[model samples]
Target: MAVSNQEQTPVEAEERGARARTARLMLDTAVQLMQGGIVPSVSDVAEAAGVSRATAYRYFPSQAALVQAVVDEALGPILDWKSASVEATERVGDLLSSSLPRIDAFEATFRAALKLSLDQWAQRQAGTQGSEPQFTRGHRIDLLRDAVAPLRGRIPEAGLDRLGKALSLLFGIEALIVIKDIWGGSAEEAREVVLWAANALMAAAEAEADKS
Candidate 1:
């Protein structure tokens, strides 16, 4: 029996909704485990969430995949960040201010993701990471590029790219780990350092642009 498109549309939507709900459940479970200082595998999360292993595996095939999903969820707000300001410096400042607090709050989760990525790197170096999906991290690139869009023509193309890359260092978990953990700075101190570095980078870029 052939189903009309209209008849199948609602069914497909419902199925998608169900899948999304299940995936969210697993992610939430994973985050909880991560917060408790446990790096959970997909099977661990599935068992905790009361979901079937096969269905959970369909959503996150490995520990790396599961942790990556949790990290992405933690960073969902930053990924959707938008600024209406046309001033590149203001736009970048706003993004850093808005995102730094979120990163501080999820410090543990982000550090865990970093640890997993480093573990993968080490395993690959030892030729032990056979066919496992790698969890790559790059959200800061697009966000920084968008923040500096107003400076696109003002700065040389290579300069714009360099600015974005430099700003990326100040935007994410790495900054928190450095300023807060390694340097023993408070959250407020970390934010100040990041803002200072970001502004300095912009000023240097602007100065170079003036010379050129």
Candidate 2:
């Protein structure tokens, strides 16, 4: 079916532009609040952005929407990452090298996101989660699988999955926090350790594939 023309009228266009500006303002405010390690609600962002609660709610609708927008903004570059290397280990190293620093830079925001995820988990366990949307996290799974794509035909699917799970323990904000916070190591140390672990996992996967 040929789609009919549905262009907006001049007034409608102007209204859309205004709404877009307001949404951007609210989203920017949310990012700023999250950067301070605060998983802000829509009302919090509205107050910070000087926008009315009604208007902010119109754009974000819920805390889940607002926090998710901030996460997508923070995750933009890492999600778009691609490697030129053909070797699985080298590609994994490249990804870690490129992504760890970015993750470090947004450390506070990610930690705040993690806090939200954990809070939702606890609330759910207590049956007090109410209608609040649960915060979700698992981007590392797909990323790790892609990084290890070179082993697709070499290893069993279960082996590849296990490798992804193992490497995940060494990736993301948790890795940085464990190395930097618990062990009192620096960001560089975290990066080196993650890179080393990822390479080791790749080697293990390749060896397992050889046995198969």
Candidate 3:
């Protein structure tokens, strides 16, 4: 018996929905494990998610892949960052103010992601990471550029790039960890300090642009 196209369409849609649900379950489980400070392997995520190892591996073939998925999920909001401000400083401030709280909320997950990246770095340095894919980090670059987009015409291209680099230093989990953990500041204090530094850096960049 030949199956009609209409019948096959619904079947395909149902299959896709099931696959998406399973993937989401695995990702959510991986994130929860990361938040608990356990850098989960695919199999670990499978067990915690009550999914079969085979199924979980199908979604994320390696620890690096799994961890990256969780990191991307944790960064969903920040990645979608938007601001209505026309001023470069104001846009940067809005981005920081809105994102700092989110970063603090997922501090543990971000720390775990950072740990994985550092571990991969150390392994590569020691010539022990083997053929495993390295965990690279750099989402802040684009976000910072977007935050400072309003200054492109006003500042030189070099100045804009320098401003982005300076702002990146004060943007992500690294900054929060430094300000909160190393400096023993509270979350609010860290946010305040980062905003202050971010604005200061922008002001300096603008002044430098004026001079040039």
lDDT of 2 by residue, 95-191 (tens): 8888898898889999999999888988999999999877778888888889989889898888888888898898799999899889999999998
TM-score of each: 0.90, 0.94, 0.92
Candidate 1: deviation at residue 16, Å?
5.5
For residue 187, model 2's alpha carbon misses the true position, in angstroms, by 0.5
By TM-score rank, best first, the candidates go 2, 3, 1
lDDT of each candidate versus the true structure: 0.88, 0.87, 0.88
Off by over 4 Å in 2: 1-6
lDDT of 3 at 9: 68
Runs with alpha carbons beyond 4 Å of true place in candidate 3: 1-10
Worst 10 residues of 1 by lDDT: 2-11
* Model 3 residue 120 lDDT score: 89
- Every model: Cα RMSD to truth: 2.1, 2.4, 2.1
